[model samples]
Target: MAAKRRRPAGKGAGAIGCAPFFVLIVVALIIQYWWVLLIAVGVVALTVALVRSTSGPARPAKVPPPPRPQPVVAPPRAVPTGEDLTAQLRAHKRISRVRDMQEWDYEWIRLAHPGKSVREVNDIANTHFARGRSIGINWGDPSAP
Candidate 1:
């Protein structure tokens, strides 16, 4: 004869039976300890509020510091002024005049004797320079005049 199936004895009814009782106990405890639950919730809310407040606004990934100011200093030389400034300007003008005269002399020589090479121009000017010196007059270079 085949053995008839027997149900597992205690497992079925006991676990199912305990669920409502457990739920009823938890509901009773919650009613009695309501203030504790409130306090726990308040603590969690306070922690979240503090964390958010302390975090503040989002910041840039990297911030470069402002550059340091450099000390402004006068140049290491004295500023030319008064007679010194005048002399400096006058010397520059005289040098410029000498350059102008030399340029004019070359142009004049080139025009006066067309087809003369530069070497011939130098020779002509040198030959004429000593002639006017005896008369206390400068020649070749019109710079002195």
Candidate 2:
């Protein structure tokens, strides 16, 4: 195989060709105000130094370590079990019984008056049952457990 051609090293014409422009500026420096020449030389030197120092784009900075995780804590209370559930149900039943006992006076007065007929009470219960059934049908659910 033929030998591979080596690429040229260092800056090409684009870098070296600026010499004529620099020479012209130096010549003008001799003719013009000294302060203007000084400023121009300073700016040119700063630019050349910056370009030479940073020839490539900057790389991304390295990331620092993440903060350590904190330890987890749990509540000090115990979870309710089947016995707790049964106790809650017993409490609800006690409350319901108290309410029924208080309402018994009104039920006794109604029974003494005999205002509502058994047929009327049955009709009302049937209507309520029908309404509950319709609601259950519409929702596509089984009867409440």
C-alpha RMSD for every candidate: 13.4, 20.4
TM-score of each: 0.36, 0.23
TM for candidate 1 is 0.36
Supply candidate 2's per-residue lDDT for 121.
54
Worst 10 residues of 1 by lDDT: 128-137
Looking at model 2, report the run of 10 residues with the lowest lDDT sum.
133-142
State the lDDT of candidate 2 residue by residue for 32-72, as single tens digits: 78888789999999999999898598878999999999888
Candidate 1, overall lDDT? 0.76
Collision pairs in model 1: none
Give lDDT: candidate 1, residue 23.
98
Off by over 4 Å in 1: 1-75, 126-145
- Please provide, for model 1 over 10-106, each residue's C-alpha lDDT reduced to its tens digit, 9 standing for 90 to 100: 6676657668989999999999999999999999999999998896678878978989999998889988999999999999998787667666765
